[model samples]
Structures are given as structure tokens and as C-alpha cells.
Target: MTLGRSAGGVRLQDVADLAGVSMKTVSNVVHDYEHVSEAMRDKVQAAIDALGYRPNLTARRLATGKTGMIALAIPEIDQFYFAELGRHIGEEAARYGYRILVEQTLNDVEAERAVIRDRDEGLVDGVIFQPARIDTLEIARLRPGTPLVLLGEAARPVNTDHVMIDNTRAARDGVEMLLGRGRRRIAFLATVHGDITESTHLRLLGYQEALLAAGVGLDAHLVLQSEGFGFEDGVRAISSAIAAGVEFDAVLCRDDLFAMAALRGLEIAGRRVPEDVAVLGWDDTAVARYSTPALSSVSPDKQALASAAFALLEDRMQGYDGSGRHEIVAHSIIERATT
Candidate 1:
């Protein structure tokens, strides 16, 4: 006999009956038990699809004490980099039957603190955080009573898992590549220049290291600071340098957006690329390849970063009480017309 809870309501028993399995077996399949045989799982899944069964999340969480939801906090969702990161993380979480709640911190310290101090407990199983302006000391003091995975170089070696690329090394390699093209007077176009963040600091260190290694004198004038990380900022930085008679044969922009802008600015100034000045950028975003003159960039392993972050968060949720984990994904340079 088929058990019916109410009209148009499908219960667990319905699935079990459809799959010709016991209720316990249906529950095992629903909960993703590892020991379930492949054939059995397939049969149960087929039954579920036929019946369109969906477990009640509230009941599941109440019984399991897990919300099956994680929060992803980044600076902004509109920005291409963060948007791409969010999409990857959301897809990854979905693979494990979890959902990701995305939040924008706007790179503000107070906003980041608010996210850390979220009052709703168990609303999310954990957090994958990318802090922009919050200091490490402040982050160390927060009582975020949940699992956390740090997504970038900031807030490192904290009481959480960290996934990142070697910013310093990548930056150094970018400069070295420019140097190899016989470009000595390389300008560093950076965002957040005066109050440097961890990423900016590391990239600058790498730039200086490359210069010193190549026996090139570091010209203070060659380092241009910008208030923003955008095309206009790149244009302004390069244009201002030109107006000031600051001689430079190349530019190492902090990101692809800036590099594309620098290219336009250089073109407007009647400078030829490769022949007169070469440009390099980091992040190797999609737009880099299609820019007017394809931009050379530092391509970090973004897929690896997302995978590692999800793994760390899952381990934490599974009650792994080990010390903080730090994983650095690899990066490489993509050569193009600019350099």
C-alpha cells in the first residue's frame, strides 16, 4: 500500500516505494551516505527525479544541526573578478548539496566587521571570506562562532584556512618579463598606494625585488599610485607620468583593467607598444585576451583557489579540529602583444 501525507505532497515513503527500497535506504540516499552502492544510488536517484522529491531543508537542518548553507563575503559583486569568484564558489558548493549566500563588503572595515559579527547563528554553516580593509589584529579579535575559510592573502596565518596565490612572486615575474624585453624604466601602476593592503604590499615587494635583482635602479618617480583599480585610473596614472616628463619604457599595472587603460593612454600619447613601451598586467582576466592589442598578464589558478577553499570549508564543517590550513595555488605569465 502507498502512504499519502496529503494531496500533492510527496513524502519519504513515496520515494522508497517508488524505488522499491526501505525508508532507511531512501534516507541514506538523501543524506549522501558514502557506503550506498552505485547501482542502489542510481535507482534511488531515478526514483527521486520521477517523484520530484526535495527534502525539507528546515527539518533536515533541525535533525542534522547543519544549515547546508555557506556565506561568501567579497568586496563587491559587480566587479568582474569578484563576480567570477562568486559564481565558481556557488557552483562548487552546489556540488556538495550546499548553497552559498553572497555578501558585499565594499572593502570597508566596518562592513566587513558587520559580516563577521552577523547575529544570526546557524543561518550559514560557515563563511568563505575575502577581507579588503579589515586589519589582521581586528580580525583576530572577532568572535565569529563558525567555520571560516580565508580566500586571499589578507588575514593570513589566522585561526582559519587560507587560499591564495604567491602575489609577490607573480609580481616579480611580471617585472622580470618586462625586463627581459630590454625595458628598464618600468612604471608600477597600483591601486591603494599610500595605505597599502596585503596584496598591494606583496606585489610592490616583488616589483622591487625584480628591479634589484636585475641591477636596475629603483626610480621613485616610476611608481605611480592611483586611488582606484579601474581603466580611468590607469589612464590617469600613465598620462600624469607622461605630463610630468617621467620617462618610462614599460608599465606593470596591478590588474588587467588598468593595463588595458594604460594601453589606450600610451596609444593616445603616440607611443608604440613593443617598439617603444611594453605593458604587463596581473589577473589575466578574460578581457585581457581580447583587448585592442592583446594584453600580457599573470594568470593565477582561479579554479584551484575555489576548489581548495571549498575543501577547507567542508573539512571545517565536518569537525576537523586541526590547525589552520594554508594553500598557495600556482600562477603563470601569459605572453601577448604588449610584452
Candidate 2:
């Protein structure tokens, strides 16, 4: 005299049997499909709780060709903008009933390739590729027939889907803000020059355009290009520029972290912000809101970018055979005492 089955394994059938529902209905509930009636779903969920059942994500993926998991690839997690973006993206994916996998590439070419290849070989359902080095082999691995969304960074030829803020416009507006405050001798602190990605070129173009419109010449001396994007690099760039006796009325950093190092260097030299030289940075991170004088920078809606990324990726996974799409999120400048 025993019951029909024991609930030790917590399989789909356990919930189905206990709830007296079809396995398909159970699948729909677990997958968060829209069609399952609330009353029926409630019964299934109650049984699932009683049995402590967990959906077999692997098997479900096998049957439906979906893992309910997506990947995000980036250079590092320390940068405030990237870190903030990562957090928002995670929340957005969870909102859509998807799990996230993160891959750190350290901005190296080979490491980026390895991660993309791993994702392509069944490790993940789709990816949000943030290209560090867009080489052919790497591009080939990430060229998504599966869902793929590109994040903001350097640019590459788009035969794929992407979502990002208007980086060029953001930069241009930052420079224009500085100019509007009656600062003409403005400097552009770049992490790199002549890069294939249009991020650098476009932002620089904005700087030039703004300068020319204001009757200011684009001086090569004011362009401080760093080999890397880091605090120490910023320190070195400022120190080197000072040694070369380059003169400028203001410094605009590509990122706020670099702006910090620039500010530090200037402070040690007894120069007051906006009094001796005005300073501006991009990507309004936590540092921007709480720095010494508080930083004034533009904020690109990271959550909007994330939402766009996942939506497009999910569509692609559902066999979306559409052309590549791109989204340029709106950005607004935040004014603080530093400006």
C-alpha cells in the first residue's frame, strides 16, 4: 500500500501529477509564457512548492533549443560606467525571466576570442558582445545567428544587432558645454588616437566641430593621447604634458576615472578647478556625483541600453530573421560644482 510515486527528484512530472495538469502547461509556467491562465498556473506553482520541484533547464533547453541564459562580455568590472551598466543589464535580463553570464576579457584580443568561441559552442544561448578587439577570427566567432547584441565601446562594422548611447553626441555636447562657459583653450584627453572604432574619431570630430564653430583652432599640442585608459595613465599623461609645457585652459576626459587622476595631478600642483583650468569628464558615474567638487558629466541611460540589448537578443533567439538593428540611447548632462 504505497502512493503512486515519491517526490525525491522534483522533476516536471511530479508537479504535473500533483497538480493534475499537462506537462506542456507546466513547461509554460516555468518558462513564463504568456498563455498560462493565472488560476491553473497557481495550482501548478503550489504543487511545485510542495514537491520542492525545480525545472530542468538543461533538458528544457534541449527540447526547445533555449537555455534561458545570456552572456555579457566586457573588458573589466572596475570601471564605474561598465560596472554600473553591468548591474542594470543584469536586472533587466532578470525582469525578462533570463539569467546572465559574465565574461571578462581584460581588453585582450585572445581572451575575447576564447570567450566568444566558448559561447558559440553551446555554453550560452546568446551573447551581448562588447568588442575590445574586433579581429576577423573574433568577429567570426561572435557573428550571431543566435541572439547577439553589441554594447557601447569601440565600434566595428555592423552586420549584427547593437544598442548603445550616442557616444559622439555625448562627447560633442560635453565640449560644447565647456566652450559655452567661455573656455576656449580646451584639451581633449584621449585614451587612444587613430583607432579603427569610430568612438574615438567621432568624439574627436565633435570636439573639433565645437571648437571650429566657436572660432578656436584645433591644436595638436592640447591633444593628450594615452596608451591606456587608467588612473595611472592619466597621471602620466598630465605629468608628461606639463613637462612638455603644453598650455590649455581646460581638460575634458574621455571617462570620469581619468578625470579624477587629472584632477589629482592638478590639485598637487596647486591649481584650482575651474579657476585655473576647467575640467569635464564623460559617463556620469558615482565618482561624478561625490568627487571633491563633485563632477559634472553626461549620463547615458545604461538601463535603456540594457533593455534594448536583451529585447533584440531574445528576438533573435526566437528565430528572428531580420536585418541588424541599432539603438542610440538619449544622454543628458549633469551639472555639478566642478563645471
Candidate 3:
């Protein structure tokens, strides 16, 4: 049967009439109300599709006081790990009929604060923030009543939701893999020069724990510090360590970029990977699979992290006012030729 449209185009009433349901049912389906039955949702959806009905986002936002948009603020989208995580978040958000507005803070304190401020200004319904330089106190001060979910290794406010893998455990697992492969003189890379971030501190602790467990003495010289977490930073660290006559049979990197760069640096120094020096990286990004001698990596469940973030954020958006919830996603070691 042909469905007639109102002068303002396809309306909720038209879909309701076509589906033989109340307008409330059609509205609930369009708004993704969780209490609606699957059969009713399907029926309303069919009518909506048949009538080519499109939601008026402005009207909906004015009526419901929600924009159906969420901000995903990260340090840098250029980084493989963050980029991959963003992809998972976008996909998961779509499942809930929400759009993601990504903001890159570039690890800048002001930039991170600006994203939170924008969220408070009603540009989006909520925010999923992966902070790099900002602290929990600052975030709490800025966020106020806004719905926010924290990601990454930054300190989580007691009143905010958080989702991440156990960084210390993942780091230890990667180092233990190297130790089991008979790599005694293992070097821990990715130490920064200035103030230590919580992530670096936890990962470094894990590395130390693994060495201690294997009866290997901690070598302060082997804990290499870099200016940044970049390709050149890894190369520079390796070159400096070698020049200083630091002896290490294996390397545990903070990320794939460092691990890949170390491969190049080792090749230049006439060292064979996994033979002369085994290497392990974090975040099993796509590059790890195709890298020469495929890098062994600590792979965090990105999809799970995204799912958990959204679940927590959804609760907050739905007016669940309570203390923060912290979620730890699973992680694993993807061993390959590098180890």
C-alpha cells in the first residue's frame, strides 16, 4: 500500500499508520528506546524504510535535549593505535545510532581542556576522552555535570567512567615472553625524560617485575629514555645506547612504531632480530603483521574497550548519576618471528 506523506514530508504518524502502531512506538523505534520489543522495532523500521522517513535531528534535539552525538577526543589520530581505537569507537557508536565527533588534542593540555569545554557547551551529548597530558583533577574540574568516559593510562577521576586494558600486566606478559625465549639482557624502551606518565610508570614497573622474576638484575643503563614516542625517537635511543656500549640481547617497546624503528636500527647495527636480539611491541597494529620478521606484540582488545566505553557513557547519558565505574578489557601477546 502507498503511504501518503504530510506537507512537511514523511512524519512519525505516517510510519505509525503504515506499521499499524501508535506514534509513540514509531518514536521509540526512531529514538532507539531500549524497552521496545524487537518485533515492534522491526515493524516500525520497515514502515520507516518504505516511507523513506528521515529524522529531523534539530527537532529531535530540541525536543529531547540530546544531540545524538558524542565526542571522541584522543592525543593523536596519526598514531596507529589511536587511529585503530577510533575506528572501533566509531563502529560501536553507529550501533547505538550515535555519531562520533573526533577531536585530536595532540597531547596538548590546552587542547584537551578545550575538547571538554566544547562538550559542556552542548555541541555533543557526551565525550570519550583519552587524555595524555591532563590530569584527573583538571578533568573533574572542567567536566562538572557533563557525561564523560576516560580512556588510556591517565588517572581516572572517582566520579568518571573509565575503560582500558591492564597496562602493567600486559607489559609484564610481553617481557616474560622475551625472558622465556632466553633473552636475559632485555632492554626496556620508551622511557620519557620529563615527568613520568602513569602508563609509562606502570609499564616500567611490569618490565622490572619480569626481570626480577627471571633472576635477572635490573640494569639502569638498559632502561632507555627517549624524547618522544616516535620512529626517530626509537632510532635515536637505540643509536645512543649502542654508542654508550649498553649491552642488551632483546628489546621491549612501548608501541609498534618503536618496535618497527628498532628493527631498522638493529639492521643498521648488523643485529639479527630474534636471533641476536628479540623484540616485542605493544598494540598489535596492522603494521606489526607486515613488518619484516613480523613483530611480536601486546594486543589490547580495542573493540572491547570501545564497547565498554560506550556502555558506560550510555549509562551516564541516561541519567545514571553515581560514582565512576572502571572497566578492564582483555589483552594478549601475539607472538611472531620477532620473539
Q: Find the candidate with the highest TM-score and give its number.
A: 1
- Across 1-339, the per-residue lDDT of candidate 1 in tens digits comes to 123221347888898999999988988888899999999999999998998887777766766788778999998898766777788888889998898888898888888988778725678988999998876677767856788888877787557688999999999999998888889999988655555368878888999999999999999998887767767877887888898999999988878888888888898899999679898988888788888788898888777888899999899889997878889999999999988
Using lDDT as the yardstick, the better of models 1 and 3 is: 3
Which regions in candidate 1 have their CA more than 4 angstroms from the true location?
1-8, 191-196
Per-residue lDDT for 244 in model 3? Answer: 89
Pairwise TM-score winner, candidates 1 and 3: 1
Query: What overall lDDT, based on C-alpha atoms, would model 1 receive against the true structure?
Result: 0.84
Against the unseen true structure, what C-alpha lDDT does each candidate score?
Answer: 0.84, 0.77, 0.87
**Per-residue lDDT for 153-256 in model 2, tens only?**
56444567777777777877888899888888888877563344556666777788878877888899888878676788887787678778888778888788
Task: Write down the lDDT that model 2 would get.
Answer: 0.77
Q: What TM-score, over all chains together, does every model reach?
A: 0.93, 0.88, 0.91
Predicted model with the maximum lDDT: 3
Tell me the RMSD of model 2 versus the true structure: 3.6
Residue 32 of model 2, lDDT score: 77
